[model samples]
Target chain A: MSEVVSALAGARASGMVELADAGATGMITLRGDHALLGAAVQAVLGLAMPEVRRVVAGEGAQVLWMSPDELLVITGYDVAPGLAADLQSALGDAFATVAVVSDARALIRLSGAQARDVLAKLCPVDFADFPVGALRRTRAAQVAAAVWRTSDSDWSLICFRSVAGYVWEALVTVAQPGGEVALYR
Target chain B: MLLLTCPCCGVTAEETEFANGGEAHLKRFGPGSDDADYEAYMFARKNPRGVHFERWRHIYGCGKWFLMARCTMTLEVFGTYRAQTSEPPAEIVAKIKARRPEWEGF
Candidate 1:
């Protein structure tokens, strides 16, 4: 098991912004017939993949609609191991591929009073329409990710594991005190 | 830019994600067809006012071939569905069955 580290520990921007550690979190990929995979995903995660321009939230999980036949599932830091196995079993030969990539992704939670302000400076999506229950599995800053607003003023952003450091540094830079700024990794 | 609705992706992405398939709903020409029919078949299409169905490729995202319904006059895109997605081919069914050796009796 890899040692868990805060996504933004040493990279703090002098009391301006803080980074939430999300390395321990798990990320999974679910692919199949959209309908069948959606059913299996809902059955296993208690959350249905949201429609295009929409999102469905669960207790500790989130389903972002990536494509018509692809979805990115974000589970709790410590979710059930059986979840992936069960999905594989249920999907069986129905899906073209079902990969449990909890370890393949590095999860991060970006939250602060100015989180939205920070995001607005970076992303092109109309954050005005993004609500608490809204999830957008689109690209931000030219990087594909699952962007969601956990609350009216709070948001969560995730990306592939390898680029987590770069994203964290970028977020920290923009989150500095006062106006928008940039940070280094 | 042409707006394409990806049924598989369920999003109306910009034409950037889609590739144009020559013509849609074309019929095969039979032997001894007339010259006029050949001309019409060779280079012609119906430029409709509303509800034009065409074939588009979702190249960037899913890489799945699908059908899209749009309005030519207004350029309003409606819905999309995968090619052969509605029903599986017999060969695909047989291949799937053969690949699943675990499903002996179930």
Candidate 2:
């Protein structure tokens, strides 16, 4: 049997932006009422439920508010199942649904001074208004993606596993030095 | 391109982030309805030049369906609201009326 490699294994860093595969991150899709889901997430991950279009980071987990009644919980890949289970137990019969979707999606981390610049090339969201902890579900190039700002110079983007390769290539292509032209900034 | 704000996620994104679901607040004409009523329900849409209500899905964003009230000609967005309601909220209707005095209620 052959071991699986990340889509960004051979991706070259552009110095201005660093791209890395956020290896085997755990992802859980949660759906339910805001109050119930928020409580469950806080109980399981010890992180406050983020406001709409925001993200909250805990010790080892991050909760992203995807919609009014939906959230995406991210943790270490190995711990995703356990987290989902914990969330399920926490919200049992509370009009909530929990599904482990770690393998359904791929995550990539972009950091450095020009990370936002690289993203602006493909995404339409104005990063200037996207403060840290802001999370947005938008299109990255041609693929559906969710982007979360983790820090001043860091962002994490997730796309479906099927298009991981395409998304990675697109980001790498735009992240290349002098590839991005700052139109908004 | 129109920029829409998804009420569910509070993310204001470009038109590309959203998929237009067409005229909102359509009353369904099910079986046993008159031909004219059914035809109107199926085909008739009010393409007003001024105030209009629309259904838009945040397809690439929070994936929630929402409603937007705006002026078709002026491109002035009155507001966006959740899709769960059967009709536009009173506040939104009032806002539109305040902006366009000749506007009629939905």
Candidate 3:
């Protein structure tokens, strides 16, 4: 097993203001004909359309519903390349179009006591009912993102590459060590 | 929360996702048309205090606009249908009659 990276090192390398990126986590985006995406995603990852809005995550994998038809899926950093190819093959040309966006996003994981509270202050969506295992496709701070709760106290927020640096800076600055903010790698 | 049923997207979504576009089935008088008729068309309206038929757009969902009749006092929703369609659904008519007994069978 690989040794866990130090929180301070993870934060500095990730440059996140809220929470640090484990730096090795893989982020991918799947966009296709909205009608076909649900089944395609289901076939690729054994997950279905996340129906709980911002409060629940899909069972097998951390799936966040980005829109009525769009979704975001997160997994271990090392699994990305193979999964991207598998996803592309599953939904060939029959589905209008299929695009595997493996490198278009920045994946940041925020865990700790103050994670939810800090997210609430940064994003507009109501967090009171946002339960673990749910995915939310909404604006994080002011940027478009797909947020998925991996556990009771941890969440994965994915955003576009352009604003990735900004988001990282914001989370790291607010994330404290002992109480409100904690870094997980 | 107010619920809107879109013809394309079906029955789902909160009122915040939609925009109210005013009364449904109301016709407008052209400038070249008769004067009194224009006056009646422009100024006169159903203005019903009970259930009112209105147009609403599902801005955040399927993006299709629809017409629905809902109670103003009770806020009870009747039914919804496509905006450009010729007539309201029979279910909507039935709901209107059921809610407003005076308009029964009309």
Quote the chain B TM-score of every prediction.
0.59, 0.93, 0.83
Tens digits of per-residue lDDT, candidate 2, A1-185, equal 56545445544455558988877678899998999998998888888878878899988888998888899988887788898999999998888899998878888999887778888888998887878998888999987999989999889999998999899888888877767576535
Q: Is the docking of candidate 1 incorrect, acceptable, medium or high quality?
A: incorrect
Write model 1 residue lDDT over A41-136, tens digit each, in one string.
878887765876456777787777766667777776466356777778877777456766776655556666566667766564446555676665
Stretches off by above 4 angstroms in model 1 are: A1-17, A77-80, A180-185, B1-106
Residue A2 miss distance in model 2 (angstroms):
9.2
True-vs-predicted CA distance for residue A169, candidate 1, Å: 1.4
- The Cα error of candidate 2 at residue B64, in Å, is 1.0
Q: Candidate 3 lDDT, tens digit per residue, A67-161?
A: 44455566665676677678777777655343445456777778665667667656654566666766654465556666667787778777777
| Alpha-carbon deviation at A36 in model 3, angstroms | 4.3
Residue A5 of model 2, lDDT score: 52
Q: What C-alpha lDDT, on a 0 to 100 scale, does residue A104 get in candidate 2?
A: 85
Q: Write the per-residue lDDT of candidate 3 for residues B1-106, one digit (tens) a residue.
A: 6766666456354576577888788777898989988998888877777878889986544446788888887777887877876567788788787768786332
- Candidate 2 — which pairs collide? none
- What order do candidates take by lDDT, descending? 2, 3, 1
Winner on DockQ (2 vs 3): 2
What lDDT does candidate 2 reach at residue B85?
87
lDDT of each: 0.63, 0.86, 0.63
Which of 1 and 3 is ahead in lDDT? 3
Better of 1 and 2 by TM-score: 2
